[model samples]
Target: MSAVPEPAAVKTAVITGADSGIGRAAAVRLAEAGMDVGITWHTDEAGAERTAREVRERGRLAAVARMDLTRLPEAADTVDALADELGDRVDVLVNNAGTGSAVPFLDLGLDDVRRVLDVNLVGPFLCAQRAARRMIARGEGGRIVNVTSVHEHQPRVGAAPYCAAKGGLGLLTQAMALELAEHGITVNAVAPGEIATPMTGQEDTDVRTVSRPGVPLGRPGDAREAAAVIAFLAGPDASYVTGASWSVDGGMMLMGPMAGSHLTGDDWRRP
Candidate 1:
């Protein structure tokens, strides 16, 4: 692709794992903001199609591809392919694909840990590199948002591998932000807390009715809540923001000290 002047407004975005949950939300949200989007899914092509349909409904172009993060370097190529479909423009990239394990630390096997790392850390790492290179080649600034979990900052008892991967990705976001700032690129992490999504086994449930006493908001967050943050980071409004971790946790992260002292049983030890 040849270099071209940057558009005044972001035109295209590529989001990984857009088959469902936060990924799907972000895709539609970006489309609503007048951006064409390329979506990637792991094993749910039907769900991806649904997400694409929503994007197109907003009159924005949408493309879909199967991306298996476990495939490593090869899987990341999906990023370039999607950019090609978007007319060779990649203004924003959302590294939202990830996997998790609920097994205790001692019970975690080597292979399980590797799998988590591959999906959560390594895959996003490579995908961002591809998007960043394309952005640089076009001589246009870009945006990159990594969807980390609240665990990225705090630890949980049964999520050893998940925590490790998210924590690593969190730091990686900062490093990339610093290095890419010169290129007019901004990198940030959107760390989400308990959200009512398929990944949390609460798909389609009304979060307002589900009380979460531990969270100051007293309820789980909606996927759209997190997507709003991602959209802000990708849009022109957040041009000056970089290397920041925006928590969409509904104040869950603020309960660390309160939860630590109020725990009355060992139930928290199990996943």
Candidate 2:
């Protein structure tokens, strides 16, 4: 019998803010799918290490790096550093690191607004640019997934900065997809609503435990649920998917009109 040729090595995925929440879930899921993972954390070194451990447990190489999105260029450099650690190539980049603000628009500070934009919008732009450059240079197609929010499409009472940043990111995803398509790189966004994660102050809680009347599903979404969408966008199945925003929000967007009709007072508009 003729000898069979060995398959090529698995690709690598770099996920920002992988210390926890959707980022961590995506990292683990990608690792499970046989891709080496590079995880980045801002202030949660321990959490990043835990995620890396989970990735390694799945029998994939895992690398960890500290990335502060405020330092956009430096933060982008971490992707290159991680690629260096993971065989000099990056096949997927997940811009999941972000910050949120809840102050009323009138009370929001200028500095705080800038911080949110820097982290949520500019940071991801730089990171994606860096990854795209590498992918284009490598002459291989790649994936880029941005984690936006339901607020990207709808307004939130006290989340002016967050909403603005996410909305901008949503459009940026489409623009990048248009520009990067020629290079065979797909750019997409995942908009998650009421996900059970530390960012929502729901750590260690089952999504089923939360009650969200606005969501048709009647509960929050699990981090893994959002991660599954990201994993799909980053995998070969999404080869034809680009310039799109996937709502992993359990039909939350559908309740907008209903929520507006049920609003009986002006209190929601108050600071």
Candidate 3:
């Protein structure tokens, strides 16, 4: 019997915050899977370049752009610029550029809250809107994978704004999915737990082992593993799956109330 030929790759994806952490990993992994990736960085031009180099080395085209999501005025323009760089077409868009804050609710400044919302929610919404327009214009469907966090469902004591932004993003994903379904566009989210990356920078100790004992997976997730999940959702395989938030969180969310109660130290007093 004769062998069948492999299918050719068809798409280009734009990944924000591609300079580091999950963004960088997604860029590299998607490119390795034979998809061209458009990389965007907020400040780390060098880091973005490094990721772009890896993509090209893997035999995929990569286009790098500078984008500061916190600046809402530039969010749509940033997406348009990236699409232009990719020859006026984009097949997938991953909204991953976000910041973390350990600021307590009482201590959080208004500016900080706005910054988080602008970057995590507004930025992604604007970018997705722009990308969807291009996809519609080209008369082809597209995919949008929002890089949310485990905090989207679970609460973190010192991370009020972060949690709020991610939760909003989860809802936004659902909303986008419903509205875009007619156009064959899918919207989904990848909510990762504690992943080993520059953002978590806990090299000396594994927080997941000591802090998250209730989780089915004892250790923290690697950025690449999280990236693989995002890549799957971005690919054609996830066409039927939309408006869903996939938890790549070592089963943390599944641990229920007991797991959350264990993380609370407020009841413990030093008398």
Candidate 4:
């Protein structure tokens, strides 16, 4: 009998804001699963290189680029550039770059709100469009995972812009999923709650040491925990799953009603 040839391996994945935290974790996870990764950072080239080193240590190819999500259509060029460096195809795109504003709605400046939306919403939109176009052109299925927050489904008191941008992204994920299904593309969002990442000022701290009473999990989530869920969505098992916002929040979304009832005064509204 003749020997059978194995299929060729897929090309690469482009992950934005992958210098640290959940983005870095996801990059490492996917690389461990035998995928080459392209990492992008805003101001942390050193951190990005560190992540690339980790990916390389896993025996996968790694590429790095600078991507400022606020730069819009121009920033999205990084995706193409990365694809060019990684065999001219991107099999997965993770839009994990985002910024948040802690100011109250009334206290927020227009520029601040715009900046948040530019990073969290507009940036993902542009990148997804660009990646999807490439995926469709290549006639191969692709995956897109947007790293939203718990606020994507619920509102936060002091994070007006962040909440709004995440909420919009939740819908955008569904929209992309619907429109891209015919092209074998899957679009989804991962909503993480209270992850122990630098964004929460918890970098290098053990998540088990943090107490989050409101979260049913009793402690903040680990960045790797969130990354695992993202990895599942990007892998072959998620071929049938699309247009879903997977909550990697440790059941925190279930505490909304109980938390609201416990709020006894206006102090909670003051930021």
Report the number of backbone clashes for model 4. 0
Error of 2 at 235 (Å): 0.4
Q: Find the candidate with the highest TM-score and give its number.
A: 1
Candidate 4 at 237: error in angstroms?
0.6
Alpha-carbon runs more than 4 Å astray in model 4: 1-10, 257-271
lDDT tens string, model 1, 1-271? 2333443579999999999999999999999999999999998999999999999999999999999999989999999999999999899999998889889898999999999999999999999999999988877789999999988999888788999999999999999999888788899999998888888898888998886666767778899999999999999999889999999987878876246324455455457
Query: Where does candidate 2 have its weakest 10-residue lDDT segment?
Result: 1-10
Name model 2 segments beyond 4 Å from true.
1-10, 257-271
Better of 2 and 4 by lDDT: 2
Superposition-based RMSD of candidate 3 using all C-alpha atoms, in angstroms: 6.2
Q: What does candidate 2's lDDT look like per residue over 1-271, in tens digits?
A: 2222222233999999999999999999999988999999999999999999999999999999999988857778999999999999999999999999879899999999999999999999999998989888877778999999988899888888999999999999999998888778889999998888999889778777766665667778899999999999998888889999999887878867246324444454346
Query: lDDT scores for all predictions?
Result: 0.90, 0.88, 0.83, 0.87
Tell me the TM-score of model 4: 0.91
Clashes of each: 0, 0, 0, 0
The global Cα lDDT (0 to 1) of model 2 is 0.88
Candidate 1 global lDDT: 0.90
lDDT of 4 by residue, 213-240 (tens): 6666667789999999999888888888
Ranking by lDDT: 1, 2, 4, 3
10 residues in a row with least lDDT, candidate 1: 257-266
Candidate 1 residues lying further than 4 Å off, grouped into runs, are 1-7, 257-271
